[model samples]
Target chain A: MAMSVDLPALEQTAAPRAAAAARWSRYARPVLGLVLPVALALGWELVVALGYSNGRLVPPPSKVFETIVALAKSGELSRHILATLWRVGAGFALGVVAGTIMGAISGYWDFAKRLLDPTVQALRAIPSLAWVPLFVLWLGIFETSKVALIAVGVFFPIYLGVMGAILAVDRKIVEVGRVFRLSGPAMIRRILLPAVLPAYVVSLRVGLGLGWMFVVAAELIGASEGLGYLLLDGQQLGKPAQILAAIVIFAILGKLTDWLIEVAAAPLLRWQDAFGARGGQ
Target chain B: MLALKEVGKTYPNGVHALERFSAEISPGEIVAIIGGSGCGKSTLLRAIAGLDRASTGSVTLDNAPITSPHAEIGIIFQEPRLLPWLSVADNIGFGLADLPAEVRRERIAAALARVGLADKAVAWPRELSGGQAQRVAIARALVPQPEVLLLDEPFSALDAFTRRDLQDHLLDLWADTRPTLILVTHDVDEAVVLADRVLVMRPRPGRLFEEITINLARPRDRKSELFDTFKRRVLTALDRSLDRSVRDVTDKSSAGEAMWW
Candidate 1:
């Protein structure tokens, strides 16, 4: 009824300006998302120009960028990045595999859960950093200690994620699996794992974030190379640009790894429409 | 053929959901069990599907005791339980894992076509409406070509129009496949319209009260007097069962009033 009454008015008054405004609306969200970071960087540059804080003590964005370029030219940046990546990669892989397997065993079998769940619950209460000194004492100040520390940090969240996913699977769907007479391995592979992918991916992201935090702690205590070592070296040498450079690298790498995981999991999780991301995509 | 011999279920909390429930379904017959809520209609269906065990007696399919789920029996739940991660075709092909790849594809395609959803072969379950999702679930169960089909209030949640449409579709599918079907429903008209024999059950300790055969011809007319007669018979049986409980409640309340006096 409204359409019938308003049709002529809409046709006459909907101007080209409105059409252009509608066309530009699509880019508004992305531009708005980017505005704050650009503004912050500009403010930082202005502060540096006005001599706010000693330039030597707190390097501006340009000096940090220059340090990054120099580090890249000397192949130092890639070396540190590779070292840090190796630690996170190895630790994350070990943690996810071990956590998922143990989680599944406990989640599926009552006897195993009865034996292991209490211990896991108790261990989860201890801080991940508390294990670092003990790990260094046992394994020495080698790569094992750093990797093991990150692994321990990554383990708890993933373990909890897996258990929650498995336990909360819809009972009706499980009944369908039973109706089809799907065996244990087939049911796990086809149904349970796929059902838990979104939750598991969330845990993976959390583990990766925690992994970075643990790597810095391990390197701060004892390490020769990697971005964490660079952080300590910057502090001791009083090179603010180097310190800012390390911090920027950590931020960039964290975002990059998260993007990579999202890209990898997108196709596998295309069937999901519950996250409110479907309409935009 | 499937048979339930004095099958009974008692929960751990000692609620007797079913008692001495016995029935035999022939190779290609449609049987409907009509009862009120908590009449153990769902429990009886689950026992036949090997999803729940009857504590007292046994449910056997083709002379084999149903100790666990078997591939030869297909069950459609009240909710459409499609795995959301899978495409429509994959969900339909779920129970065909043991078949050859080409055969599985053929069967899935056929099932989709049967359900008039051939165009939605690749659609996700979440993309479908309630009725469409239910149809996909039907396809999934049908693709297995099981010998026995069990339905537990499969159309009760749908709108009236969708319910009628799916009911007709189900009848067509049954006519074509000739699988022995056992449908549990509370709708008396549905029981009369679809079943070869309608079994009316009473609640308390759930047991069969009466079995009424519908001798009406194929494509039975709902407007016909005979159809109404059968519907009335089932309804009367249900009302009579409910009336007993209502009278018992009233009697207990009046006895309390007498104590006050």
Candidate 2:
């Protein structure tokens, strides 16, 4: 539509208010969000030192830190972390791509949905770790099995999220597509994809977190060098500090990956933020 | 010419949305279809745009039957319906995807200029105000350079001031492009302000009740007596249609009662 008005002028006038809000969010919110976590860590250190649970099961925070520092000095920390990272990256990528393709196809076409949905739904009920034995038998006790397990873990949330998002798209917008005489492929590309994107991103984060959880399960079977391997090693060697360190690493890594996904999706989600702003107007 | 030859629509569940709805719209003529809720104003417009089909009879543009949505027929629904993902220019240029990039850009730019949103080419639809989004919708509809433009309560959701502003914008557009315009609305004032002739519709088996020609000059004053006269006339016709429908229902019941009496 031809609209000739000067939007920049209006935006310039509104820019200062938006700038102030952004300034507050950029600096303050993250610090505020971190407050509880930092407090909990300090409190946990005090409790363990004060003989809570006899300081054996949980280990003292200082002991865990020392183990982390020792591991870092020997470069074992980097090696294990890198190994886990690679597996998660490979598995998550494969899962999300495949899930999105299949989800979009089934969501848009009734024929595809009819053929694939029932089986996918039934399989989704089976836990990701349940496939560990089967995957190991087929792919062996190597990186392939570990990655495949994580991939299976990641796939379901994304598949379900994308399909649900597509189904939930406003019928009014689809009618707009029909009015424009958009071809079937064109409708899916322009209308369906964008319509489902915000929910798909949320599912991506969920799938990534699930993939991390399954890493331990995958590594429980003949894995040599990952965070999961560290956990098993600490258990076998009877080292509480090492096990605690692995748990800490998993927690931090999970949060970090979720943050990265959100950052990656910010551009796509900008329109939604603008939509909320328009509502206030 | 755009023509509906006794076009009718009956839903699969047996609801008669429209029946024998016929009209002849010459090139550049502005026609408004006004009816109360459930009178099938939107159904008629949808049938004309070929978004929906007639159960009986036919809708034609240039004598070719319209069985499905034709690109040459542009429509503006009640909501702006701009794809939230696209910028204003991209939304306007959406239907023009088959054109070369340069030609499409040129057309988009021209359309933006026409709707007074030339500077908003890169702005997202979410950034636009309700009126602005509606204007973008108008641009999107007009950019395709369609032979017939159909609007279904296009400004009903807007506030009075915004609605009036858009009404003026639409008139300017009609004056410029002169495409055969068919607008469906319930507002009597809106019908009188923009249409060359207004067609009133009756409920139940929706059909045309009467057609009133609006002979006001360009940029018709909403405050003028002539404008009020046309509004009153349309309102009277609307009242007549409602009364007639009610009477028909009572007559049917009374005929059964007469046999028992």
Candidate 3:
């Protein structure tokens, strides 16, 4: 179809202020979504004020908030957050690059599928914690074992997601590639890679969650210092306050990292469909 | 400029698609091929386009025997076949990647402008209507400056008005490109509308049943008495061929048997 105008034209056609207004309007819903949590916090404060559970089984959100602040002040929060971040940083980088390339190979070549798919699937069946024992045995109870554990956890889902994305490239588009007489390498670069972006971005998001979970499990086994190490130390010392602080940090950090992935993915995804008839592919 | 000699085909399950078929196409001629289902019209086009090998026979272009897909010979299937990932401009520029980048860009621009989608260069394929996508397909074919363009029932999916618009646009492209154009379709009215020569085909070993040189003028007025007369004649011939299947009229090579052999 011959569309005389493009997205830029559409943007221009909309009232100039419409674009800015639309961008901010999307945020309204998310801000509203936090209302329930705010209400829960108020309820928890009242319950703790009423002397619920003698303040032993459940700590008030207020107390947890104070502990969180204290932990941040003492650099405990930043140290563990950074420590977890670095392990994931190393493992996630390796997993993404390796998985993406292998996934593409599996997508395009039947031979690669025969060679790689079964091995990855079999390896993924082993839980991250299950590998903890063997990893410590092999690499000792140091940073190496924890990073290895995190990498293993991050790799499988991403590989599967990437491979699925490659396989899901619409057959109709492949026909276009065929007609163009696109050579093998050119087809992958121009067609397959871009088509797989949606699936790959989602996989990257999954990688963050998987990596966080693995760190917790790995640290539970043994660790010098990390968020998981802090949580373990708190439980042993009977300091419910410190344990609450670490758990709270874990929850918040997971969310913030997930949001970061979305922020990074947003512009790139928009660009992919910039020229499409539809806004997103 | 292109010729098919004794092209025969049979499906794996033993259905005869074509038998001893032969047809010649000259430069700058627009030929419309029409046939019922299983008549091998598409298979013939595929064979000639070098997309598939024939069970028997040979195809030649510019007097050279054709074996593989020729860069100068293009085929447009029913769908527009644009890559979902690429923008309109990238898709139009697709096959020209081997050309210098600057030349490819210019050709993509020219092709898009020719199809009246210059502004949609960055638009994705999904945003296009069926007619627009087909226009992109046409633009894609022309971008490479192909010597021959083959179409397989391109407008059959479009609504009446959209189809009419495309027919005119196709005629415009034809006027400009002036390549050897061969279109395959099942619509008699469509054949009458777009082709210089209309060839009627029959099944049960598809062979040309009749060939009528449409001695009509450009943009042959569809509502004109002359068009109605020729349309009725072609429809009657088509009906008669379908009803009486005993006789066989084939598209033998214009050259005698041994010359092509």
Stretches off by above 4 angstroms in model 1 are: A1-28, A50-54, B245-261
**Model 2, range A11-47, lDDT digits (tens) per residue?**
8799789879888877897699889978987888898
TM-scores of all models?
0.91, 0.86, 0.86
lDDT per residue (tens digit) for residues A91-195 in model 1: 888888888888878877779888999999999899878887799889999899999988888888888888888888888887778788778887888888898
Q: How many backbone clashes are present in model 2?
A: 12
Off-target runs (Cα >4 Å) in candidate 2 are: A1-25, A40-57, A133-140, A274-281, B245-261
Whole-model lDDT per candidate: 0.85, 0.86, 0.81
Best by TM-score: 1
DockQ versus reference, model 2: 0.38
Superpose all Cα atoms of candidate 1 onto the true structure and report the RMSD in Å to 1 decimal: 6.8
Clashes of each: 0, 12, 11
Query: What does the lDDT read for residue B180 in candidate 1?
Result: 92
lDDT of 1: 0.85
Using lDDT as the yardstick, the better of models 2 and 3 is 2
True interface contacts reproduced by each model, as a fraction? 0.88, 0.59, 0.35
lDDT of 3 by residue, A44-118 (tens): 888779867466656778888888898889988898888877887887887777777787788777899999899
TM-score of decoy 1 = 0.91
Error of 3 at B200 (Å): 2.4
lDDT by residue (B1-261, candidate 3, tens digit) is 888899888878898888877778899899999878878899888888777778898889988887667888888889888877678898888788889988888888889899999878887787788888999999988878788999999899999999889988999998986988999998888888898888888877787887777778897799987787667767865776686655765433221222245
